[model samples]
Target chain A: MRNSFKKVYLLISVLMVVMLAACSEDETNATSEKSGGPVSAKIGVISYMTGPGAAYGEAITNGFNLALDEINEKGDVKIELIIEDSAGKQDQALTVAQKLMSSDDIVALLGPTLSTEMNVVGPEADINGIPIMGTSTTAAGIPQIGEYVFRNSIPESLAIPAALEKAVNKYGAKKVAILYGNDDLFTQSGFDTMKAEAENMGLEILTIETFQKGQSDYNAQLTKIKDLQPDLILASALYNEGAVIMDQARKMGIDLPFVGGNGFNSPQVIEIAGEASEGLIVATPWFGEKDDPKVQDFVKKYETEYGHKPDQFAAQAYDALYIMAEGLKNAGVADRDALRDALAEIKDLDGILGKFSFDEDGDVIMEPTVLIIKDGAFQQFE
Target chain B: MLGDIINPYHLQIISFILINIILGISIYITLSSGQLSLGNAGFMGIGAYTSALLTINFDLPIFLGIILGAVVAGVFGILIGIPALRLSGVYLAIATLGFGEVIRVIFVNWESITQGSIGLSGIPHLGRELFKTFKLTGFDPDMLGLKNNQFIYLLVVLILLLVNILLVWFFIRQNKSRVGRAFAAIKMDEKAAESMGINITYYKVLSFTQGAILAGFAGALYAHVMAYISPADFAYHRAIDILIFSIFGGSELIWGAIFGATFMTILPEALRFISDYRYMIYGVILIAMMAFRPQGIIDVSLLKWFKKKLKLKRGGSLGIGTKKYN
Candidate 1:
């Protein structure tokens, strides 16, 4: 029985090899045949727009879609967006990146958003001379992705300093406890950076606690930190863990100023943590309700269309798409080199997140926001 | 029908299937010995990262890098197996899971060596002995080289076929040898086998070690194919998914492992058309498959009986055989 199945498996493998080679041959033939006229502009998106990171993926797609809609509506540059899901799986991200690179239409790529996915997919983009702009992934050393790789999202290294500065200066918090999710790349990097920065800022790190991602109870970790009696708690975690940590800390009767990085900037954190997140402070690059007219218009449009206020994920994604489209428009041609030039030339374009600009390394040097959660609503700092 | 056969997407699908077939058979080696493994992904990751790193960072030949990657992954598997020998069942599962996680974490954290989760990029596209072919042809292979993924997929399929034939041949030989009986005896009842001088611990350790080696091969190929590796590629969830594939396909059936691998790999892609509903369907299908055909789709007599009832001739030259282990 095993033998026959093995035989079939072998047969299938053989058949697949022949078929795949044939397909590649066909694609080569087709591409070779279409050598003249205006080159079709290809915009590829490698996103986690499905699976465990579905919400974040959808938010990114929304950003990409918003940009495409505006670009296509104007009809200045002919562009085609070919999207493939990374599924938050690193291997799939690589596969999708390769598949996209194989297509001549793909001049540039947007992202495979998660830090891990970006890490895997970035190589292909660099090898193939495609520029990739990730919407949101704040892990340290993102600049190392490649010369062609660029991310507009503020790194955790930049984002954490703002929250740490607030905790040290505003709250007069001499002693701070560090809590973070271990499994998440962003959270881990943020926490580690904060730990170092906090120590460097002459603040005592009374307790450092870690919890795995997808964990519900932080009582053990929280209990250890609460016992340390730190003046403030700095948590580097996403909405679910953030909410749980806050809720659990409050329930445990530990009243101290709570601070977090970009992971803390989510409505779901407030919704889940409820009253516990009321006085929480977070450092973010962009807020849904900004003073800028452009940002306000976006918030208004997003709220009306989605029937809810957009989170930081959606806001950043929206801005990323706009910036990408602007690059395409500026390039005035479908050529990758030209599109890269267009991206390089982008300066002072008002995006939902603020002005969009790429440095030599393709990273946007954007200002960070320090927001406070006042009664369930995010109010900008004075 | 011809158009369908000639479609580019179909070819892509076929390529994917081939890749999965190699991965499936590689996974089957461990499963057939009644062991559960999650380290295949880790092995694949090692292969991918090592090959990519070698080609990109060191300017090594792609084919040489691929072989080195396989060897490296195999060595890693053996190393993991040595420590993992102390565990069994869920304990063993957790150990292997940790093993996979450690590989990913190392990949993510070791920035100096691995570019620290940004992924080692710009892997030269060629695999196995193909680099030599490229050198011989002097065809400016870098510009017109095979896509790394496609090459890896082909290599994986070819290796899988060779491995499957070898495994079948080995097992068939073993079926007539004392070693096969000892393994069978151990599988049936460990204490009894040990009492009968079968050296259960040795065999169990050997089983896991052998499984790990195959897993490493798969991992190496996968890494080369993808030309990238990150923590997310070989998470705890990945290990669980592989175990589920083995269990769902049937623990005793060799081909079941291959079938399970293909089904699991391609099922998600197929459901991708449904978007949100795809995961839901996948869950439902898994549950249904578990509830109804818990032994898997490869029950020999049942297949023959069903075929007879349907009055259909068994197509192809492949003959059905009885299960000696059972």
Candidate 2:
């Protein structure tokens, strides 16, 4: 029985190796082929196509493809895109980044969705001298990873302070409680900014609590916060946990106004929390409700393509693709260095997210919009 | 010739595989002694954080930092092993898993030291300063001027080769020594081994400590290679991955651990063409492998077949043969 099992195992191993080699070869061939016109450039698109962040990945890819299709149709620049899925893993992101960098033909790279994954791949891209633009990575020190790394997404540092000032002024919140996921770098950084801003605003912090990422139960922390009876609650959490925390906080009868960080900007928070999400205010760079033509066109196209309204993540990604195309057009992708130089020189570029520009550190400098969830929709907070 | 096959991309992947192989062997050591440890990643975290801090803060050389990290991890292993190895089966796995969580939490909450959730970045890569110093002294270090990734690749490969040789020698010596018999005796039948006057606790703790030291060493190398690490890198998922590598490769044999680590590490990258569905396919393959061959991808029969093909001595003892030591 063992001998037969060994034979089967060996056969399986050999079969897998052959399959892998064949598949990689096929991929290389597919990527190399260009239709009709000369392929002026090749760009790599990476995102979390699978795992918990699949929604964000899908939106980014959809936005990117929309832009790519438009550019290709116009025949101004024939840029071939090779998309790779990170599967929401750092190691996988590293592997994909390495693969993209070594291909020699890829002039620039984009996406990887999360900040943590970018932290893994950003340095490599910098070292290899390939410019990588992140669409949704908002954590601090990301652009500081190296010269080649850039992000269109505004960090929490810029967004949270504006939102906090609006919340404190509008609600007259005297005492506030802060809660955040301790494990995630994004949420933690959001919390740090919120705490600093709260102190700056002179809002008395009644209590500070933290929960692990992906943990559903926040009742224990909520119960403690309820007893503290803070006039307002500040939370730094992703959409899923933000929804749960809001729903549970309301259920626990802590009906104070909730001010959230950048993570709460997603419409899914409202969908998950239902009525509880009402009166919840958040600061974001992209507000889909904007009546601007460019914003409306992108949003309409995205809604038509994906059958869902484009959230902030999708909007930023849409702008990011346009920014990359503009860089490619200006630089005329003869070499990676020229493209890198072009990307660095991008300034005052108008897109869905207003006039987008990169600072010295490759971070986006943009005005943040404060919005409150009212009757299951985002409204400009007055 | 080897350089043609290994581009910078392949080099990074291969280096990670080497690190995982070291982790696999670490877990395999405990598995051989009939212990299932799910806390090796904790030791890895300790080693990574220690060495990274040492190099960044104390200006210690990378080699010395790695050694210190390994030593610290070995000491921590003994600390956890004493009480942790007392449990058996699923309970031991759970305990070790809890230990890993605790360590991760410490790394996260101990903000002043670990830099909180932001993680330590800009860790000096191996030989960056050495190459710079050589240039300053007017010595053309062109031959030694490997990029960080390339240098790390070579360093990890050398360490892997050295570790493999040491492990092989140790295993061979262990097989011939009385201590090895005690470990085997305990694994087969604890009550019988106890009656035969074998000190089970001492051997178990010793093996667990050794495994931790190996994991720590791997972690130090990983930190230097990647030039960045966070508590997230050493979370429970990593511990589980190490376990999977050991089990899938067949933990009974040393080569099984090495093969499993290499194959599994490369499998995801190989399945990259499938994109989002790749992980699903990977899950199916794992489930199928476990269902079909619970003993793992490598077994005694396969090893014997290789030996036969090579026309090696048939009478000599093999590290993973079915033949009982006694």
Best-fitting candidate, scored by DockQ = 2
- Candidate 1 per-residue C-alpha lDDT over B1-326 given as tens digits, one digit per residue, 9 for 90 to 100: 32222322333344454555556655555655555667777776776777777777788876677677777877776777767756666786677777777888788667678755345544554343454464578743335355543443444455546655676567557645776567667667777887888776667666665555555555555665555455565666756666666665665655566667766766655554455576787789789878866877555554455455334333322343333212
What range of 10 consecutive residues in model 1 chain A has the weakest lDDT sum? A26-35
Extract clashing residue pairs from model 2. none
Provide the overall lDDT of each model, using Cα atoms, as 2-decimal numbers. Answer: 0.68, 0.83
lDDT of 1 by residue, A1-382 (tens): 5466556446546744643453344234223122443334667787776676788888777766666676667766555677767778775666566666666666788877887777666765776678888878787766676787888898888777876786578768889888887656678778878888998999988888878778988888888887888998889888887888899899999988788888777888778888888777887877866678887887787777777777777777777777777786676566677777788778888877776677777777777888888877878754
Candidate 1's docking class is: incorrect
Runs in model 2 deviating more than 4 A are A1-6, A19-39, B1-5, B127-165, B172-176, B312-326
Clashes of 1: 8
TM-score of each candidate structure, all chains considered together: 0.78, 0.92
Per-residue error for A259 in candidate 2, Å, reads 1.4
